[model samples]
Target chain A: MIIAVASGKGGTGKTTVATSLALVLGNRAQILDCDVEEPNCHILLKPTILTTDTVNLPVPSVDLEKCSLCGKCGEVCQFSAIVLIGKTILTFPELCHGCGSCSILCPEKAIREIPRNIGVIETGFVKDLDFVQGRIRIGEAMSPPLIREVKTKINRDKIAILDSPPGASCPVITTVKNTDFVIMVTEPTPFGLNDLEIAVEAIKGLRIPMGIVINRSDIGDSSARDFCNNNGLPLLMEIPHHRKVAEGYAQGAPLIESMPGYGHKFKKLSDDIQMIISESYEGASI
Target chain B: MKIAVTSTGKTIESAMDPRFGRAPYILIVDDNCNLIEAIDNSANVNAFRGAGIQAAKAIADRKVDMLLTGRCGPNAFTTLEAAGVKVGIEQSGTVREAVERVKKNEVSIADKPNAEAHW
Candidate 1:
């Protein structure tokens, strides 16, 4: 099963949980950190990277010689990437979505797609756990395309544990779209609850089954539990606020790897997730 | 100086400004607070990332030493700081009014609660 760990806000320990899960799963699982802007999974797992690939987005290159004054390309582009003046076609490569409709409809066929480097995808192995992630260029406007490129590393034979970017925006959606299941990590604060509600709405809209994993569970209020109970979603796991875990994270050691006992808990979560998925499928089959 | 403006409507007139709602254009007065040249910042509405570089470029292109108007995000704020521009905050007025406010030192910069699009 493809399980994504996501949150609606930043700094909620999504990477910690994801990396721990991947480490425990070992050869049985793969991990994809789709948080291109600020990926932190690699920081903990310290995988031996085998190969790296750069991701490129398509941008329009306008050929001025054959271009006419026709504005159809600009009109069809929802992003306003192309603009046709009296005799010049002004193109904004940054805003272009590379829909390719402009080049297809151009009377003079003056527009061509060019490779615009956006980010890089890195892949490697830490023991039996496979890892892949995307890192977007600092100044690039688009990120969904690069996130998609990174996900192509997913191996179907093994379980894919996806560490997703924060929030319910396009990047988060791009990371979690069509995954088999989602494990959302949140805290017990008013801010966390508010964002969790937004995440719940999005998960419902996408028709994806999800469970809650409350981080810093010991310190926060029980509002997260109340919400999960009311919504009929399972409380998958609760990771207490521990100082050693923080130290472990800072020292670049996977929590489950450093503390052998914690590995059992992660294995249990993985098993429980599979059980939940199987129950849902059996119910549907009946 | 050229400035970065973040309004919805196109051009200098008939604008649906996100910053001031009805103003034709609102350059971030004292753009050092933000580091953009033009007040036409579209990062909040259209972009997923890279707001600082793009917005700062628009204003920096105009040789702006200060950024003026409305909220500032950490990403944009840090980029401007590195570029040696000052950030001034809390602006809601016509672009002309903002320019005058900066000249009079009436506007002050503060961190916005969210990343972008205050309205």
Candidate 2:
């Protein structure tokens, strides 16, 4: 089963939960870090470098010689990446979505797509656990493309845990879209609750079964927990704010490594997710 | 020479819109400070991305020789420069006043964009 660990707010322990789950599952799991903008899963898992693939986005390259400055290319482009001004057809490669609309709609056939290096995906192993991560080229506006590249590394035979980026926007959606279950790591704070609600709304539209994991559960107000209760979303785990765990995390230690007691709990969490998915399937059929 | 002043209103008497990409109106004026045309730029104000490039294209479409605005971003500056539009940045007050200042050679043409992209 493919499971994604996400948080609407940043620094909410998504990497912690995701890496820990991979550690507990050992050889049975593969963790794919889809947070291309700033992937942190490798920091926790410390996977050995095996293979590296450079990912590129195909942006339009206009051939002005055979070109008709018919303004067709500009008209077809929705992002305003290419515009025909006066006698010149200007192409802003960074703004291009790589949709190929401009190239496909050109009557003169003057536009051809050229690859622009956007990011790189690295795949390796942490002992028996398979690890993959996407690192977007700095200053690249788009992350969904690179996130898609990261998801392509998901291995079906093992439990794939995707460590998603923060926020309920395109990147997060790209990460959690087709996953079997999503574990939303959050805190009890209002900021956490607010973003979590937005994220839940986004994921709900995707029709994926998701649960909540409240980190630093002992400190902040119970609003995040309250939100889950009112929304009928299951509260999967609550990890209290402990100095040892924080210290261990600061040292790049996985939650299971820092606190071995939580390893069994994460194993149980995985089992619970299986139960939830199965129950949902049964409900859908009925 | 035809000059385009980024304006908040259609008339030349309106206050200068500080933003280049999200400006509501771009009033085209002559060297004599006469309002020739007003290009509505409301569409770019709500654009999610590439607003500056779209607005630059709009300005260039009008065949303006110069642009008088409060600030010009890198993308808009590059597009305007390509279209042979001399940009006068950090010009405030009424659109007519800005045009008059440009005609008087009081406002220096910007050699580089004053603001960063998306500013």
lDDT of 1 at A201: 82
A116-191, model 2: which lDDT tens digit per residue? 9999999999999998999999988899999998888888999999999999999999989999999999999989
- Candidate 2 docking: what grade? medium
Residue A167 error, candidate 2, Å: 1.6
Single out the weakest 10-residue window by summed lDDT for candidate 1 chain A: A80-89
Interface-residue RMSD per candidate?
A: 10.0, 0.8
Tell me the DockQ of each model, to 2 decimals. Answer: 0.05, 0.77
DockQ of 1: 0.05
The TM-score of predicted model 1 comes to 0.73
Candidate 1 error regions (>4 Å): B1-119
lDDT of 1 by residue, A1-286 (tens): 7899999868878998899998888899999989999989989988899888888877788888877757678667766566553345556666677779889988899888898788899998888888898889998768899888888888999999999988898888888988888999999888888898898788778877899999888876888899999999999998888888878878988878666678889999999999988887887799
Candidate number achieving the greatest TM-score relative to the actual structure: 2
